[model samples]
Target: MPVSPTDPVSPIDPDSTTGPDSTIGTAAAIAAATIAAAAAADDSTGTDALPYAGGNPYADYRHGEFAFTALTDLADRRLGGAVLAANDELFAERENLLLPEPAEFRPHTFGNKGQIMDGWETRRRRGAGTARPHPTAEDHDWALIRLGVPGIVHGVVVDTAHFRGNYPRQIAVEATELPGTPGPEELLAADWEPLVPRSPVRGHAANGFAVASRRRVTHLRLSQYPDGGIARLRVHGEARPDPAWLAALGTFDLAALEYGGAVEDASDRFFSPPANMIMPGRSRSMGDGWENRRRRDEGHDWVRLRLAGRGVVRAVEIDTGYYVGNAAGWAALYGRDEHGAPDDWFELVPRTRLQPDAVHRLLLPGARPVTHVRLDVFPDGGIARLRLHGSLLDD
Candidate 1:
């Protein structure tokens, strides 16, 4: 049954009418109500449901069209960080754009240059008449950022929050790949491909664009028409890990995001992203982990992760760093082979009491290879990271 957004309540009663029109109407209404209720609930809890709505002035901003949420941020500075260089950063720092923390708004945070902003801000250009350090430089600002993990970029988010009037009128993105560490001049000379065409952008909002490239890239170039400020840049994509690197490391964390692992499913993403549980390093704060709403029912919350590679599990590390009182009370683990049926899942760890803001390392009884793992948390609470230490199976 298809649901119409306008009429959520059914008009025809099942007991009173059995006509074709009445039956259709009843089903449609019920479907509409169910969808609306689910969307409303997800939005209220700040979970990743549908794309963000409200306050965006751009009429062309389509919801859920951009692949921003599904992919990981390859250019995130906190994930090993990236090397950033800019033509000019007279007003603010360029590296702040890739910071893992959300842009801050400190009313009185200033420096000798001027009012310090938590973003990449350049001095306004005064045209060719003004003397400049680079006489032949173009009449625009640009920044180059090397991605922490080289991968195929699926989309980008140019967050210009708090940069209202000072935001760029248009923005474009380009990507490139090169061997070894290259200097600024060499990076600029490499053949760059367009990921996002020059397009109009709105201020004080997240501007998303779907990239069309399938080529793996290691660096990105952001060009803003003229000169302005940009708060953040998020390049989302699937990580294409180096095969040789994985071979050298041998046994590693199969569920680690840096190694291409991902959260396939979760009971809920109400408070924090489930993918955070597999991200590199311990969570810095309570908000930097996978957290769900407290459960009132008999069932508990669980998250499924695709292993980075087929591997025999030897040990596991469940970290509840920073969760404290909100951490899960108990947890269990399950695993299955790639060709195994859903019901064929086997237990890896039995349900055990979990200590708040602590680490639990459990050695498995056997060295069974698994392609996926499911972590079940009793009731509902936060988990910082799930480390599955295992030796990779030869291809």
Candidate 2:
């Protein structure tokens, strides 16, 4: 799904903790377990294969394991993903699942429950028994997660980081579409379809799973077979939003993920994901933006995106809000009707000097229908938001 065939994998960005608000600062998580479940991972899927012998298995999933994992994280809290409810989080709070950073392990960090962990953890379960009855195979601990941008999950990463000994032996993932706001009770009862069937997991490893379901998912039910810890859960997919809702707003950010726009490919994703550039609402802080490492050599860094649909462009907003010292030096936007030769793209906004931590609204040269766009940032820096303001074209 490259806008350009030259879309080689860029350097993996250093681990970053970039969720920007209480609503998202620390939300949902995706996890993978030990090598024991390595067989379960579909090696046929590029996103499930690790290109390098890793230092951190969890790190592989983002750039190495599954290429699709690099797509927009549908359950990212920054995009409004939430860990709505968990049958149990008695050990580690469920919110830690989506911290937007690596799960750190601290020695002897004790809470009232015992040792504190950075990912979701649940207490051991005991079935109804006269003695110390073991938890039946049917017993499982579960958590409900609301997708930030509803879409079809292409792949999932289950990281059991720091959950070595206490990680669940098996896990399963199920999803369903609930367009409107749903309460915990209602969501729990909603019809659900399996995304990943019950599978073994190894502790302290990033376990990757390939999902084949084509249904648009709004929420996920993650189950830990018979109760155990799970560090994080990531659902990577393309956003599939309702066009009718977008039409109701009339003029809107045609590039908004909730409206179906997507980060097609990027040169980098560091400090934060490039996908954040089109997320809804104003960026709350520097961490709410997309950033890349400083370029030591030549050409500028760029991020290409798929527009919600064919739309006429009028103006654009490049926000560097809160990126005082690290804002891009200059930026530009280009448009394309479909993926083709490099020259198929035309300029939307010429390269213009950017003010640090400021919002710049620049009008396009003229109106034209564009189905894709590419944003180029001079040298290397972070951008809080990239708003493509325009109206959609009729089918």
Clash number for each model? 0, 24
Q: After superposition, which runs of candidate 2 have C-alpha atoms over 4 Å from their true positions? A: 1-9, 12-64, 268-272, 284-287, 339-343
Misplaced by over 4 Å in model 1 are 1-67, 108-110, 130-138, 340-343
How do the residues 1-395 of candidate 2 rate in per-residue lDDT, one tens digit apiece? 11111122345432333211111111122113212233444444322233334365344332224445655678876678899999899989999776666677666679778988888999999978878588888899999999987887877878777676688878999999987899899998899999999987766666777676778989999999888887777777778877788788777888988788877666676456787788788998887779787777676777877788888889899999999888999998888875344347788888899999899988776777888888989988999999998888886
TM-score of 1: 0.79
133: Cα error in model 1, Å: 18
What is the lDDT, from 0 to 100, of the residue 106 in candidate 2? 67
lDDT of 2: 0.74
Query: How does candidate 1 score on lDDT?
Result: 0.72
How accurate locally is residue 175 in candidate 1, as Cα lDDT from 0 to 100?
A: 90
Q: Candidate 1 on 1-395: residue-level lDDT in tens?
A: 01101111122222333332122212123223332332332112221222324453333222222323345678877565464689999988899888866565555567898777878999877645546543233467899998877777767778776665687878999999887777789998899999998876666556666665779988899998778888888777767677688899998888887887866556666777777888788888887888888777776777777787788889999999999889999999999887556446789999999999999999998787798888989987999989999878895
Instruction: For model 2, state the Cα shift of residue 209 in Å.
Output: 0.4
| lDDT (0 to 1) per candidate | 0.72, 0.74
